[model samples]
Target: MNWKKPITSSLKSLSLSIALVCAGTYIAHAETVGEPEKEELKFGFIKLTDMAPIAIAYENGYFEDEGLYVTIEAQANWKVLLNGVIDGTLDGAHMLAGQPIAATMGYGTKAHIITPFSMDLNGNAITVSNDIWKKMKPNIPKMADGRPVHPIKADSLKPVIESLASEGKPFKMGMVFPVSTHNYELRYWLAAGGIHPGYYAPHKGDNSGQIDAQALLSVTPPPQMPSTMEAGTIHGYCVGEPWNQQAVFKGIGVPVVTDYEIWKNNPEKVFGITAAFAEKYPNTTIRLTRALIRAAKWLDDNSNANRPAAVKILSQSNYVGADYDVIANSMTGTFEYEKGDKRAVPDFNVFFRYNATYPYYSDAIWYLTQMRRWGQISDDKSDQWYKDLAAKVYRPDIYAKAAQSLIDDKLIPANEFPDFTKENGFKAPQQHFIDDIVYDGNQPNAYLEKFKLGLKKGDKL
Candidate 1:
């Protein structure tokens, strides 16, 4: 819908004037960075608040600053979005961190997808139907204010699930996709509470992931989650912002816990492109990453003072398309758990701070560990296999090029990014998981051995 022209003309002129003034000092660097081989690009995204980086990049003229014109379209669902990228209908997409890893490993669709940018962290939550919340409230310990305590554990839901099971009713919950962060987080929470969320024994041809499940988990696309639960088809769902807040707004469900509390600052979605796309359009790849990095920085700038305006842009029909208040509830540094029980959660939807945009191989490995734990990987492989696959899918090399170019232009500070020279793609041992298990990405199999539930070493479904 001609999203490019209005901002492009003005921004391009300004950038050109700036380049001319600094020609003597910057000409050599500019000459080394050639024009984007593919300037006009179409990127796809699901309708969620975390898609804001793509929206902000386009709306803020960051794409134009890189001498590129871009079109951002909201796809119907994650699978459709991934298919669009694979089929060349979409140049790239805001994808689940696991999509590329899973695709490359041949879990679902076989494709060589890779991510140079991670979109955001800690934006998803688990919401139970109002009735389930009612059943659960009695079992949960409360505070002096008579409010349920923060970081409510799924253990509180165990008794409720037991009651439902005794009645011969299966306790069904929904996640957005098999390899989605929502799915893994939901499984982690359920398993920590001693409720088996089930497994996917693909080697045995049972991809339903319902094997030995106490809580039957199925896939419901993000946008349809609230309605799907409201219709009594599902009791709860795990999804990104706006939808979780949508249930809270509609009086249909209560968001029990956010993914932040499940695993602090966990990586969520990523900016993914075909391996061929990155190889063929190296300059374009780096330019797009540069634009996204700038957009992410802008989103998190000034203590998120820009969030309200960003929320307005996301509320428009073409982007997230949710009510401003619903998106703002989470996007603007607070989350509503029960109706009117809003609390400050500054890292609720991280875009740039904590290196949120950097594509870490450790992040990719965490998803793989979850896949293996849940039997999505089916059998044990050497730890090197996990590391090698993560290296193949998460391309920090491209991200580094983009970030370095921005730093060289004095657009961002070097201190804002990892020390690329000394940096290895692994994060330090992470310990904020709901179960309190320590995860050192360098030792994926060791981390897998720590989990009490799901497949471990020498275990197969």
Candidate 2:
């Protein structure tokens, strides 16, 4: 017919089709998304076994699975670790549950730090130096075998504090940080037995926390607690593992009671970041939370079948660095107070069971109440303010998102978590304190009033 014209039209059609295919491929290539906002991150932690969830996340490839490159650095102390997170030198870090609260509230170092993950529960104990333990042992009730009663209360130490005061000597106790769980737990134990742990009045320029004191509480690094007590620098200390176990090994001190005995399943360390970091990398934040949730679940899964292996990982010189036995003393579901006094404390280091990783507002409010109790919060904040701040900083919504994503992925079961649909961020009134005084996080002011010691409503320093 008309071969040249037909051939030319056919060639044009072929070229157009080829061009369309090329353009489609180019569009698909251009639309391919990049990785989440930030991928490489540095996290800080103390050399304490309670920092296990962070270590497990990094060591078990959970972070890599999330496309995150993480570096875990052991910090010199809590203050330096917190400062690193605040200045963006570190992305996030393991922290005391109260660090974010006190920092956000302008207590120690003012920074808008927050945590979506609570690290673990109940890894700390109140340890008295050998001499003090010797003196306090007499007051402690005896067992059938004549061993000092277990879970020795602060009342046992009252006469020692009194005798020290009578001799014009200050009775000193060490807590790792002013805003640490150790501080509150130690103070709670002391006050429960009628030993005043002084006060903190930032408004009065006395952030020392040693005003009107009965027992002087001060700061000591966690790892140094045993040695400091040995040197006679402090009489007793409240610190997290494996330092308490370290004391038993060194034969320098005896751990009288654990924080678990003081308050069962209490929130201990948390994984914290500055609000600015979280805001800048939202997806990265959620991904990191997801990894941590997996780590925590792995920790408590199958009734802590993985803890022995975890203790081995933690005992490596790079991590917690204590002997395997020392780390295992508490990590493997039991704790040692005096050298041979090993007791079955299955919840000594709760990583997941009992919603240990969930950042509950009630947990935050409880810490706030303790801060107010010891004067870390100088002014009289209304009860609503406490609840509001707890709600703001302890974001259960963010936690639920990470947890639900894990369940959706079949990484963990629905039974492993609190019923997110019905959780109000408040725990059902806790009655587990050593004092047997009920602590309902909903009624913080009234809870404060129940304490014969500590700051109360309308009471300013």
Candidate 3:
């Protein structure tokens, strides 16, 4: 609970000054990184396409250019990936945006995890089994061509849930983790449609998060989602691609909606490292961020001109381990909602543009608000407390230093990043949730108050 100690220290602050000085003499208008304190670095990631930044950084030599020798390995799942970083087996990893927030807040793991870079935005989707889709299809309005309408709302599934309830069967669903964005987004979508996705009473020793539930959600890894649903273990799941598209390809399930429709340009995965790692290797931390920033720019460059090449790499067994077409279904600026119902959604997988890589405090606050909203926080908290906790976990100061160095290196155009001078870390109020809720980071307690199905100030489960 001692989040008061700043994630950065005097030595960490000095690393930026030193990098700037070295940039002046290294090359004409080029900011060169110093020799890394640790050169042999191994990073961990789950087998999801959102881990593209890390793979691209390694394949494109962005990491080597920063004097870092990197090895990228696929972890078994989120817990293994997080544990790899926490135990120092992996230097850093692609993480759920909520993992660091939850870890720092003492929700599941009590480690001080921090993220200097957000990996990408809007790459997850909610998919349902063929049977459930068949039942929900009648409720969803169809286009003239008989295609189910896009951005399918969970309201269409309510009658199905009720029917199952009448038969004394629980409506089952899956998300990757308790604190994952997938879990929150699925819960939000279900609740917006008047279905109680349920809550967690950690204080009551229930991490099950199934207290008073209508749709019972459980953890299922990304790659296993389609098979799990196929086996009737769960009816559907919310997970990042190519798992969703894999379901569509296998003909086992149909994706109901994308996270983009749930919350536009929502912050997704982040590059997470321990606070101890950041403090001990400040130069390495900034250097890796710079590399990742470049990789992200490449992914979104020329209006995603590099996606085909990126998808080819992600299809490798050591990376996402999915077919190129499955990865490309969404990564190439379009998404397949139902088979033969593909649609153009250019912003479906944003890496760099819209300042997607910057570790914004507002992004951190949103996840914290969801935790509070769903009773994971377990108590009412002051607005300032939310703000303080966000500041502790999201290191925009580190992000700023890394960004400025990229600008200095002329590696990425200065215009590609946020204006560090005027940046106060909080984004303007976001109003993109499917529920029509407006979220202002500075007023998190107020934001939580707006949700009918979640905990708010003075409310306990």
Candidate 4:
């Protein structure tokens, strides 16, 4: 009767109210992340386990969730990957933490590249060839079980280098790139042990980085590290997994120390895109950051419950291309130093924990300080110069935008990230270096003065 008409009207009103609420929610989400400006994208990465964030973002549909269709290509090397990003062949890349910093500073491939996400922390190790390890073994302090003590310092190798030097042989080691974290880490380790890893005087057109070096350090791509050392082309190398693990599996070398031991939870790779790309496709930039953030969280979620699956994905031919066991040796929370000397290193490959995804200016400054310390900058830079360069390359502004949107969507907790309201982009003074040097990112020059082996104020390479 008439009651039926009233009921129908109420139902229509309720439907309209619900529709309005849904529209409001949709509008909020749209404001949070607009439609991606570029849908189909290509990203480049070297075949290392830290590239897991990119692979996971694509495979786990996080990119799809942000309306992005991504194609991941494993590049021939870091330079190729960086060049692809520079030339527009790749929209972004999993880059060495130093690549963007060095690029922005005009050290190599003068282009304005920036990172909104730090990929992972502490995934590199320095491995010595079997012959070298055999020589070094007697020098290392052994535990009661006859196993070498953890965090084996480069001091154990110093005598070996000296002996080689006396024999008129150049003690050579390999790092991935000129500005790679591996290079800096190796140099740090060597210098800490009273062995000079050399310096580069780019100003003098001396890019070899062998000026008065005790241990000659040169570039060798990550995947080639094990082979290069096995072939005796290099005595040792600092590289990321699964190459270090590959050496362990092949019994060609023994990993002496990891970057985590060299510098605890040190920043490693970053997701890099040209600054022009970020400006041209802001939505795509943030959306990709969002996808990477989600992937990082997934990687470290539930105490790394997802790593076995991640290792399987990385082991596929198109990705890291290493065997599953090789990648899993480190990716699953344990790292093998020597054959049958596997030990738990839970943070060996941190993806999200400790705010690993945040692109801190402090992290950028660390790399810049290293560049200056190692003579890549070739001259003194003011503290302000470091902050300015760091601001240009490490875009935590972009990171906060992406991270906060995720928080707004209730996908992640606020406590999981640094307090955006209070984050000044500088981490607290880090004191975990192998040499026990303190790094205060706000004071780059001061930090440089603390290093006994690096250039200091008024010093030029």
Candidate 5:
């Protein structure tokens, strides 16, 4: 896929604009670093709407403007995609934020993975089979118009699980990857509802995450979520956009709630590469970040003026491959819980707003705490340990370098980013979980103790 050839002409104009702003600084920097080390690059993504940034970057000449050529490929699953980056088959990938964190911590595939950019925020939802939704709807409060009140918490599903348990049937659910944000977010929502979603307990040789769980969660590829739910293999699922909408389109299930309602402005996907790759291709890393940053800015500029066109590109067969309407259900600033129940959800899929591009240490630590709570961390650790691990994996230092270059080139304003001078990469205390439990990122251990269902301090696998 010659991503550059189609956009070369537009890139020329972008290059002219960029050159005019920082020609002198660019010349000096060029003398020191030369051109980008790697120009022709292959990137991998899963067929989910959050992968839109990569497709938009390729389609909008963002990569070409950075003096690079990019090929974006959709992988079969997250494991294959991550392995491609680790083995040098893919230059980088749109990964679950937890992928880089878990891999670096040796939870599953030990690799020195790092993410300089977060792709988007709040692009996931929890969907239930039609039968399950019907069973749960009776417990839900309805509006005066009789439309079910939204932001439906998992408490509604408790009776369904209890009935299944009395019948000796296992209530099953699906998530994309073991270390995926989908898994942790689903677990977080379930636990908040007083339903134990279980733990990994890898030290005990049980990585299934069904230890003391009410609803058993397992891995299912993103594309297969709808069909698997329809076939009765799973009763419910939590996944990124398009797939959940696919269920509504197919009439097999209904999305009960979105992750936005689970945790506001939560980090979703990330651009991941090996630490060795970062060190070996420092210029290549920054250039790639620059391209992606531009793509992100364009995705959110002018109050999302470019989203309709991005929705078109993402609907193409080689990209997300879902029907345009299904992709647009959540992509174009609206989300549909049931057919004909569409409502405005402006932030349903945010790419650049609210400093979405900046990879915060707080975001990384949140995922790590979830990992520890769910037993993926396998043992207890101090708060400083969590912070140190996040610093090692989520490289805000490299992100600053990329953003500074863009700022120096006048591509983005300084106010749009964190105040780099006083920034410590940690966000202030967030109080937006579905359970309303305050999350202070600096005090991860204390936050973990507040959870009623998950592993607590000094608890072993």
Candidate 6:
């Protein structure tokens, strides 16, 4: 069998004239990959909806098509998942977007981890306990139909935090990991509303991330978010689906806002592996990237017509393991906010649209900027340092090779991928943030300067 083996998809008939563009400054294709050097593989993921790409790849037989045997396992948490990949227990994994950059930067676990593929975009939300929501509901402005206006900002919760502070109680919240997209987004939302979410000075051995904070943030596993909050351990949390939806279904919490509302189409989880694995088994690396790309494309193809099927697969015992209706609540292209407040958010769980799978340097830099802003970096560095580090960790070169081969095989059309010929790794100036700040990846320092709340140049904790 050849790499061109036609595994069916709605886009299989797309014309080559469609075109592939929007790649960036990095390594270009050297040659098409040969047979996979490593045939049997294991990939790990935490129980979250963004891990759908890995699940889809295995179930859709894309791994088999690439002459690879993949075993998928759910890890206990993000820390365990990263450790599995680092120790070679997992060939690769569905990872938090910041895990690779933080690991490579020696933030927590010092290892050279890299991502050839990004798993999905914008599948997370911030959920608050029902008690908090009752207090916040009065502060939020309402729609004509009496529903609260969408994109509920954190300012509405400020009074509640102030009240808790007056009582000498701390305002606590949960994130999945210290370096997770959840932590960054939660901090961003809280800070945007004039709440100080706190900082981490790892250089001073303070990894608590709660230094001089108004809202203390901590880590709880994704599956444990609702229960933790329900037990009054934390007032709220920022996490990925179907956990957010799980809270609403269980009537324990109300999702205050989705990450999509905080930052439109923000980059989420990525497929990560040790850099050593990629170098030692180049063919196998490219082969896996190809399968994931196919899985991602299938997920977003035909206006998400395939999501229902994906929800069914994700609800299985071995996968995300949430109830079907709970998973389908957000997986079917709409999200439920207050149980009765379901809204059509078509891109809520983007797998491939808008070049979601491409490992852009700009995306990596954004996470780095967040790290620096929150005092995790703890020092002033040159813009070039940010750019160089992003390039080192995000391997678009490998992604380009994987994408081009798929185009050659007619498994996917060129237009479906980034224009490797012209793209420069950085996305054009982006302005989707809740605070309306513009981010130009090529000018990371300038972008950081725009944030009044977080660490920029000349500021040190």
Best by TM-score: 1
Between 4 and 5, whose lDDT is larger?
A: 4
Residue 77 of model 1, lDDT score: 89
Q: Per-residue lDDT of 229-274 in model 6, one digit per residue for the tens?
A: 9999999999999999999999999998999999999999999999
TM-score-better candidate, 1 vs 3: 1
CA deviation > 4 Å runs, candidate 2: 1-35
Candidate 1 lDDT over residue span 257-314, tens digit each: 9999999999999999999999999998998898899889999999999999999999
- Clashing pairs in model 1, backbone N/Cα/C closer than 3 A: none
**Can you write out model 2's per-residue Cα lDDT over 1-461, one digit (the tens) per residue?**
00011111133355664784687521111011223478778899999998888888877767765657777889999999999998898999999999999889888778888899999998899988899988998898989987777678889889998998889999999999999999999999999899999998887788888999898999999989988999999988999999988989999999999998899889999999988887888777887898898889899989899999999999988788899999999999998878798888889999998899999899999999999888888777888999988876787887887777777777778998999999999999999888889999889988999989988888887
How do the residues 1-461 of candidate 5 rate in per-residue lDDT, one tens digit apiece? 53664222244455665874576422113222236776788999998988888887777767766667788888999999999999999989999999999898888888999999999999999999999999999999999999999789889999899999999999999999888899999998898888899878788889999988899999999999999999999998999989999999999999999999999999999999999988988877887887788888888889888888888888888999899999888988899997778888889999888989889999999999999888888778999999999998998888888888878877788888888999998888999889999999999999999988888988886
State the lDDT at 404 in candidate 5: 83
Candidate 5 lDDT (Cα, 0 to 1): 0.87
lDDT of 3 at 426: 93
Error of 6 at 175 (Å): 0.2
Q: Each candidate's lDDT (Cα)?
A: 0.91, 0.85, 0.88, 0.89, 0.87, 0.89
* TM-score, cand. 1: 0.95
What's each prediction's clash count? Answer: 0, 0, 1, 0, 0, 13
- Model 6 ranges off by over 4 Å: 1-31
Better of 1 and 6 by lDDT: 1
Query: Which number leads on lDDT?
Result: 1
Q: Write the per-residue lDDT of candidate 3 for residues 42-79, one digit (tens) a residue.
A: 89989999999988987876775666768778888899
Weakest ten-residue segment in model 5 by summed lDDT: 25-34
Backbone clash total for model 6 is: 13
lDDT of 4 by residue, 1-461 (tens): 00001111133355664784687521124247777777778888999999999888877767766767677888999888888999999999999999999898899779999999999999999999999999999999999999999788889899999999899999999999999999999999999999998889987889999998999999998989988998889998999999999999998999999999999999999999999999999988998899899899999999999999999999988888999999999999999998999999999999999989999999999988988888888778899999999999999999999988989888888999999999999999999989888999999999999888988889875
Candidate 6's displacement at residue 229, Å, is 0.5
